[model samples]
Target: MLMSPTVRSGTLVMLIALLRSPATTVAVPPPSSVQASAIGADVTAGKHLFERHCAVCHGIEGKGGRGPGLNRAQLAHAPDDTALKSVISDGISPDMPAGWFLTDEDVANLAAYVRSFSNIPSEPLPGDAVRGAGVYAKGGCSNCHIVAGAGFGYGPELSNIGIRRSAPYIRKAIVKPGATMPEGFLLVEAITPSGDKIEGIRVNEDTFSIQIKDATGQFHSLRKQDLKELQKLRGESPMPSYGGVFNTSELDDLVAYLASLRGKQ
Candidate 1:
């Protein structure tokens, strides 16, 4: 393996130890030097442990996916081993899924792995935003969309969209927009006195009735209890398919441009 000259000797040793005996149980020495040595050892162990367990979901560098970006300030001051163990064991609420599957040792190593992200700088997306700007303009993306705080208000703004969504999700959104429809585009239904049902994307609602936008952009207003079946289905986007819209290279470039938006703080 081509090792970086900057890698501390202690870190390299730890890497070798991990590669040699990944399953071996060992006591982690407490930080005593209060210097670069401790940081290097922890980071090296973290790198290997992360590669073994978290790389698939969080990327090799922990950028994100099935998990949030660990490098971000959101987790900067998260508690130490005890607190981290709970989080790793119980997990954060809402958006984050449970992490109870991890063993105590796994959690410990994983916490150290997460801490490594804080030391390394995030790699920027390798693409020309300038080129992406042209592609965005000529590709007719703004016809019903927006980018970087500008463009039509009909579609949700794409500014900083790269941060909230992953590259794969973004690609999926563009290629098959109908798959993961955004919120607010959900179809709502109401029952009528005659036992009839009507449904469409609810644009507005009051105690008595609701306004809806259908596939054709046509709006319909209906009164409450005027029909049967009132279900909110945020399924399928109305955006057109982008298959063969651009060559593979263009797609790659577009993704790179989007990824580049994940800037460092």
Candidate 2:
């Protein structure tokens, strides 16, 4: 669900404090202690599990790349254990590889690491509708995500995002992208003989030239003929899927804030 961007400024301080607490690991378990069980899982150990098995794809802290960021607020609010384990074991469709490689114990460790980023409470953020309006303007969300009849032209419009998406799902999309990245939004790069380089959203391409649209809506027509090199990659987005980027509460506020954006202005 898209969360409301409007948080009361007063609530922000309290939410931040709560987010930093050790007990904040809600919906998900506390960081499991590796010594607690023969399973030997803890956030630290889970970090190792992530690096050895997951980092190459998911990134060191699950900020996402070839994989998706795991540190999403949505995962915190969703159904527990069963849903998580299933995804871990079965994997997200298409992009994510199945987690059959992981032992159940290892999966648990991984879950802990992923869950460590959540606020762990059933309560939604104390968002202020009035404040959210300002956030929407300040956060530069319109630069990528369009909402209602306004905003930028780069990303999928959020006209009815609150209706179509859930809070957790929205959060996941922000932090971890590769798992269900919408196609056609792939970034492309080209290098010219003059040593000029360019990159943007791939619009259209052939043997001769490719088209790309940058954030500002400027289109660059890159000539394949004069290009010294051309490269296309499928990986994490330049958009920092905020894993470590946003605190759990800020994410919650953002989500709540976006959710509120549904309907008329």
lDDT of 1 by residue, 1-265 (tens): 2134387877677764664374632444464322222332344555676786667656777877534456653452254545655766675543344566666556665675676565556556555666766677777877666666667644555665565556666667677777745544555666656675655567888888788765445677877666455666556454677767976667766766665554331
Best by TM-score: 1
Please provide, for model 2 over 1-265, each residue's C-alpha lDDT reduced to its tens digit, 9 standing for 90 to 100: 0111265644544654564466763633353332122122345556677788777665565655544345555542224655666777886644456789898878877766666544333344465545655656766677777776787867667675553445556667767765545545577777879887777678888888899777677898877888888888677465656666666656667767765555552
Residue 165 CA displacement from its true place in model 1, Å: 2.2
For residue 186, what is the lDDT in candidate 2?
Answer: 79
Question: What is the C-alpha local distance difference test score of each model?
Answer: 0.59, 0.61
Query: Per-prediction TM-score, please?
Result: 0.51, 0.46
Q: Any idea how many clashes model 1 has? A: 7
